[model samples]
Target: MNIPMFTLLVGIPLVSSPVVYLFGRLTTRAQVLTRQGWIVRLLALLAVVATWFPFINLWLEFQARGRRMFFNIESIWLQLDGISFLLAAMVLTLGTLAILFSGRYMAGDFGEEKYYAMLLAMIGLMIGLGCANDLFNLWVWFEAMAVSSYLLVAFYREQPGSLEAGMKYVVQSAVGSALALLGIALVLAQTGTLDMDQIRLMVGTMDLNKAGLLAAGALFFIGFGVKVAMVPLHTWLPDAHSQAPSGISAMLSGVVIEAGLVAMLRALSTLTGFALSWGWLLLAFGALNMLYGNLLALQQSQVKRMLAFSSLSHIGYILMGLGIALVSGQPAGAQGAAFHLFTHMLMKGLAFLAVGAVMYALFHEQGIHRPLVAHDLNGISTRYPWVALSLSIALLALGGLPPLAGFMSKWQIFVAGFQSGNGWLMGFVVFAAVNSVISLAYYAPLVNRMYRRVTATSVKKGSASISWTMQLPLLLMALAVVVIGLFPSLMNWLTEPAGAALMSIFR
Candidate 1:
C-alpha cells in the first residue's frame, strides 16, 4: 500500500478532486442540502490535508535522513527542496482555509461542485510547478495552473464582469505561455537538454552567443511578468481577483500569482543564474510596480478591487527582495522575499475572507444593496464585531503597521536592502517606504469605516451575523498574523533554509 511520497503529494488532490466532484454531483440527488455541502467540504479538507503531508514528511526526513533537498523522484526528474517545501506549506494551508471559507460564501451556488474540483486542481498544479526540476515539466505545470485559475476566476459565469475578466486573464496568459515556450525551445536548441541545471550551465557560459541568449531571456522575463502581474502586465488581476468569488479572491491574491513568481524563479535559476543585469532590471520594475499599484489603489472604491491593487504593490516588495538577492547575491533579500510571501499570503487571504464575510452577511444572506465601500461598512465594528476585528487587523497588516504580520516582513526586506551595500539600493528602499505611506492613503478610508467614526442608524437587526464556519477561519488567520508579527522568528527556519538553499545553486 506504500506509494511514492512524491506521487502521493501530487496525486492526493489530483485524484481526490474527481472523487469530490462526483460525490458532490451524486449527492445532489439527496434530500438534505445541508449534509451535501458538509460532505463535499469534508472530502476536500481530507484531500488538502493529505497533500500537506509532504511538508511534514520532508521535515522528518531532514531530521532523520539529513538531506537538504529530497529527490523524491531521483536526479533525472522532479525534486523537492527547502524552497519547494516552504512554498507548498503556503499553498496548501491557504488553499484549505479558502475552501473552508467557501462553505458559507458559496452555500447555494449551482456550480459549487465545479468550484471544489477547480480549486483543488489549482493547488496540485502549483505544487507540481514548485517541485518541477526541468524546464519542460515546469512549463507543463505552469500551463495547468494557468488554465485552472482562469476557470476559477470565471466560475461565476453568469456575472458579465466575471466572464470579461476571465477572458482577459486567459488571453494574456496564453501570450505569456507562448513566449515561455519559445524561450524553452531556444534553450533546448542551444543546450540540447531540458534539464534545468544543464540549461543554467550552458547559458552561464561565456562562449554562448550573447545575442540569442538575451532574446530568449527577454521572452522568458516578459512571459513570466504576465503571470506575476508585473504592473503594465497586471490589468487582468484587479478584475480577476475582484469579480471572482471572495474565496477565489483569497486564493488568487494569496498563492496563485506567487506560483508564477515561483516558476519565474525556477526559470531564472536555470536560464540566467544570478545575472546581475537582469536583477537590476527587476529592481527598476520593483520600484515602478510599487508606485503605480499604490496610486491606482487609492482610486478604488470596491473593497476586493482595492485589495487586488494592493496585491500588485506587495508583489513589488517581493520582487525588491528578489532583486537584491540576484543583484548583490545577498541571501538576506531572498530570505526576506520568502518571509514576505508567507506573510502576504496570510494577510491578503485573511483580508479577502474578511471582506467575504462582510459580503456574505450583507449581500448573500441579508440581501442588502449597500455598495461594497467604506461608507456602507460604517458602524460595522458594532454589528459584525468578529468581521470588523479580523478585517481591521488585516488592513493594518497590509498597511505595514508595526506589531503586525505585514510590518515584520516589510522590515526584513528593508533591512535586506540596507545590507546590500549599494547606495542605489537605498534609493529603492526609500521609494518602497514612500509607497508604503501611499498605500496607507487608501487603507485609511476602510479603517475609518470600521472603527474611527460611526453615526447610529436603524439598520436591520441580526442581519450581519456570519456562520461559525466562516468566523473560525477568519479568527485563526488573524491570530496567526498577530503571532507571526510578535515572533517573526517562527518563520526563520523555513525562510532561511529556503533562501539559502536556492542561493547555493548559484555558488
Candidate 2:
C-alpha cells in the first residue's frame, strides 16, 4: 500500500463489484454458499477493508510530502492529491462500516446479493468522485453513483415508501446532473481544457467575461446545491433519507452529500482564480441554510427525517466556513469546513447506524409495518443501553455540546467566521451561533425521550436481540468521537494540510 500504487484505492473497489457479484450468485444455493449470507458480506467487508490501506498510506505520504501525487490516469483525468486523498479516506472508512453494519442489519433479506453489490458500487463510485481531478471526471463518477444510489434507495422495494424515495432521488439528481453538465460545458467553452491545473492558467490569462463567469457559477451552485440539500434545493432529502435503509442513509448523509460540496469547491477554487465574486452570495445561502434547516428539523416526529433535516443544517455550518474562506481570504475558514466535514461523518454515521440497529431489532419482532417514529425510542435505554448511549453521544456531538467532536469543529468555524472582521460576516457568525442553539433544542429532547421510563402500553417490546456486530460500529465511532474531542489537535493535523491544499489552487 505504498503511495506509488495508491490508485489501487479506487481500483480495488472497482474490481470488487464483479467479484462480489460472482459470490452473490452463489448465495442462492445452500451447499455453495451459506444461507446466512456470509459470502457476500465477507467479500464486501474485504473490499471495504482493501479500500482503506491505500488511503492510510496516501494520507501519510501527503502529510510528509505535502501535496504528493500518489497516482493518476494516463493523462491524469483523475489524480490522487492531498484534497482527494483525505476525502477518499472518509468515503472508504464510512463505506466499510456501512457494509459491516449491513451484514447484520440486513441479514436474511431477499435479493441480498444485489443489495450488497449496490453498496460496494456506491463505495467505489464515491471514492472515484473524491479523487477526480477534473470536472468531467467528476460528472462521470457522479452519474454512476446516482445510478447505484437510486437502486440502493429502492433496495427494499417490497416496503411501502422505498420505490417513491428512489424515484424522487433520481429525478432530483438527474436535474442536478443536467445543470452540472451545463456548467462544465460553460467552463470547457471558455477554457478549452478540463484539467483543473490548466483551468487555473486559462482563468488567469484568458478574457473570460463577467457574464459567462456568473452564469457558470450559478449553474454549478444550483446543481451541486441539490445534492448538498441547501435551503430551497432541499425537498428531496427528507423522503430519501427517511425511507432509505439506515446503512445506506449513513453513506448518503455522511459522505455522499459532502461529495457534492467537494466537487463544487474544486470548481470554485479554480474559478475563483478568475476573480469570481461569489463571496456575498455564499454567505447569504449559508445563513439561510442554517436558519431554515434547523427550524424544519424541530418539527419532525419521524426519527430519520429529523436527522435528515439536521443534515441540511450541518451542511450549512460547513458552507458558512467555506463561504468565510472564500469571502475573507483566510485559509483557516477552509480548515474549519474540512474539519466539520470529517467529524460530521463520524457523528452522523454513528447516529444512523445506531438508529438502524433499533429499526432492525423492531422489524423482526413487530407483526406488521413498522414506522421509525420517535415514540419507538420510548424507554429504549432500559432495553438497549448501549444503543441508547451511542445514539445519545452522536446526537450530543451533532448538537454542538462541549466535550464532543462537534463542538470543536463548530468552534473552528466560528473562529474562521470572525477572523475576517467584516461587518456582514461577523453578523452571520452571531446568527450561526444562535442557530446552533436552535439545533440543540431538537437533539436534547430526543436524547431525553430515549432515556425516559415508558409505560408498558406506550412501549412495544422487541423480541429479537441486537447482535454485537451491529453495536460494535456504533461504539467504535462513539469512542472515536470522544478521543478526537479530547485531542482537538487531530483536527489541525488532518485538515490544516487539506485546507492549505485547497487554497493553493488559487494562490
Query: What TM-score fits each model?
Result: 0.95, 0.95
Q: Looking at candidate 2, what is the lDDT of residue 496?
A: 79
Pairs with steric clashes in candidate 2: none
How well does candidate 1 score on lDDT at residue 290? 90
How many clashes (backbone N, Cα, C below 3 Å) per candidate? 0, 0
lDDT of each: 0.84, 0.82
TM-score of 2: 0.95
Model 2 has an lDDT value of: 0.82
Clashes of 1: 0
State the lDDT at 173 in candidate 2.
85
Candidate 2 lDDT over residue span 1-507, tens digit each? 344455677778878888887777777654475674787888889888977777776677766776647355566656666567557767877888888899887776777778778888888888888777788888888889888888888887988688888888899989998997899899888888888778877787777875786788788888887888878888889888888889989999999889888877777666855322666667778889888889999999888999999998899898888778877888988888888999999999899899898888776445444567887887888778899999999999999998999999899989988878888888988999999999999999988988875722334556467889888898989998988888889767668777887667646
Worst lDDT run of 10 residues, candidate 2, spans: 455-464
What is model 1's C-alpha RMSD?
A: 2.2
